[model samples]
Target: MEVAELKAIIEGLLFASGDEGITVKQLQKVLGISKETVDHLLEELKYEYERRDRGIMIMSSNEVLHLTTKPEHSDYYKKLLEVPQSSRMSQAALETLAIIAYRQPITKTEIEDIRGVKSDRPIQTLVTRSLIEEVGRKESVGKPILFGTSKEFLTYFGLTSLDELPPLPDTDEPEDINQEADLFFERFNDELE
Candidate 1:
């Protein structure tokens, strides 16, 4: 493939990697390119975005590459959070928030396991909306970010603290997951609406 096409493919790969990001080694393997070539292409792509004054740019952190919006454009992005309609969380976001609220300092993978769905978007939304935040990193391989309810979360939910959160139902038999979720939502729906 041409150099231009290679660069485009790299952009797609970075975009798909989301917040987790992709490393140069991973990119080289996937693109079947040398490490030097990957570095050169990344630098070229980074320069092109800067030269073009694009709204998004490539960022490298801990050897991982990510496609992210320019920090200079943060005011516009902050405005998105201020919009009243945008303040309302989707069902997925609410569910994710609930999980984090109850299980403070949990990893994304754990959240996904509990929800039984891919929760990247909802996690991102919660983070962006200031309801959840990276409290720390897990003490495991890759050290994934650990999320917890933020101060804003308590205020948004009209709770004095996490202690005010309703208790999860206890049962002798295995409780129905959907029913538990419904109970949680029923209690919080007033705050949500």
Candidate 2:
């Protein structure tokens, strides 16, 4: 493929990779090209982005490449973040968020076990809202998707880290799950206010 076409493809890949950036080896394998060619293309892409007035730029760290907004646009991003919460979360979503925050790296089945009800809709809503994301998959049969709070979740809650979350009380009964969720939500709302 031509250099322009190759660069376009690489841009698409970087954008799709999200926070988990793509590595040089992965790009080389995907393009079926030599490491040198991939490196050259990436350097050229970086140069082009730097030369032009682009809102997005390619970033590399730890030998991984990803596309992200330019630093100059951070003010706009902050303003966007300051927008009021579009809508209040449903009770089910709050419950799912509480469960995921306390017992993260959890799977759908585990969440269901704790709630004693189908959690698909709540999980979907959390994911859609970027509060929760698939951190990984379980190694057991079926390799179910493991869920966890995201950086956006921390930002939304005004927390510097997950360590700031209130310590969960010891409990084993499923019935107590709702109470725990309520308490967690109360703390979160207090922080928001």
Candidate 3:
């Protein structure tokens, strides 16, 4: 196929893939092209968008390729797509989810330990929402079920991979605990509104 045709096909794949970028290998396999050809096509396509003033561009991030609006266009188009509404969790559920997202493969007891509260309700809510799942059985005294975020979580969070999750501070503690709590509750209250 001509380079123009290859670029068009790759752009189609990227647009259809949305925020979850397609991988280079996947593109080559789908297009039945050599790696070098695919790599060259991608660069050409990237340049084409910029040169033509196209609103969207192809991007490769975390081994995934996707067509997305150029960053400057985000404020203009964000509302048009209505980025999927991730269900707002209660304070308890948020705490539970934060723990799971940060320390996945964690058990119920561990969550309870961190929160100093029962996790049954929050765990059930997260499970019902399909945010987390039983990853595997931990080889421990009782073989507790380990839980981790699912692909849905990745899509919901607008992440191509788990590595996209922002690194959290080392400690959850605060000598100025009250200030942090106030800020959190303020934003949490805003979301509720």
Candidate 4:
């Protein structure tokens, strides 16, 4: 297929999928072309967008591609978008998260060591809520899955990255209490309450 036709097909895919984007490999595989050629075409498409000076553009991070409107268009999108109320994390989850964030990529056993209690439930809860995810597996005996915060966690905390986390003093060691209601309530600020 001609580059012009391929570019149009790519643009159509991006628009039709909304937030999701077709990757270079997907395009190359489907088009039966090398990634170098696909990448060159993507550059051509980017130039086309740049020349058009439209509010939408293709973006890629960690090899994930998507087409999103420019930040300047956020106000307009906000008129149609409503912020959903965020759910608060349990204190156990927060404590577990702190250990995970500060000492990560930490294992479940390590988190439990710092907290001095079982963290399975809180870890499971955090994973289930999409706040924490399996970053990798430990190279140790059991090869336990290491947990870390997700993009959702950052958005919930109003942070752009994990580096924005406030430093907790090492002296203020955490403990285990399976049903501590205060910890559950204190997981998030009153604004989230």
Against the reference, the lDDT scores of all candidates come to: 0.83, 0.86, 0.75, 0.73
Candidate 1 residue runs with Cα over 4 Å from true position:
1-85, 171-183, 186-192
Superposing all C-alpha atoms, what RMSD in Å does each candidate have to the true structure?
A: 5.7, 11.2, 16.3, 13.6
Top lDDT hit: 2
Q: For model 1, how does the per-residue alpha-carbon lDDT over 42-81 read when each residue is reduced to its tens digit? A: 9999998895458899988888888999988999999986
Q: Model 1 Cα displacement at 134 (Å)?
A: 0.7
Better of 1 and 4 by lDDT: 1
Model 3 TM-score?
0.46
lDDT of 3 by residue, 10-93 (tens): 888886665456899999899999999999988888888896568887766787777877888777786865666445667777
| Candidate 4 local lDDT, residue 3 | 76
Clashes of 3: 2
Residue 148's lDDT within candidate 2 is 99
Go through the candidates in order and give the clash count of each. 0, 0, 2, 1
- Candidate 4: give the clashing pairs: 91-183
Models 1 onward score TM values of: 0.55, 0.52, 0.46, 0.46
The stretch of ten residues in a row with the least summed lDDT in candidate 2 is: 184-193
- Order of candidates by lDDT, top first? 2, 1, 3, 4
Predict model 2's lDDT versus the native.
0.86
Superposition error at 17 for model 1 (Å): 7.5
Worst 10 residues of 4 by lDDT: 176-185
Query: Lowest-lDDT window of 10 residues in candidate 3?
Result: 174-183
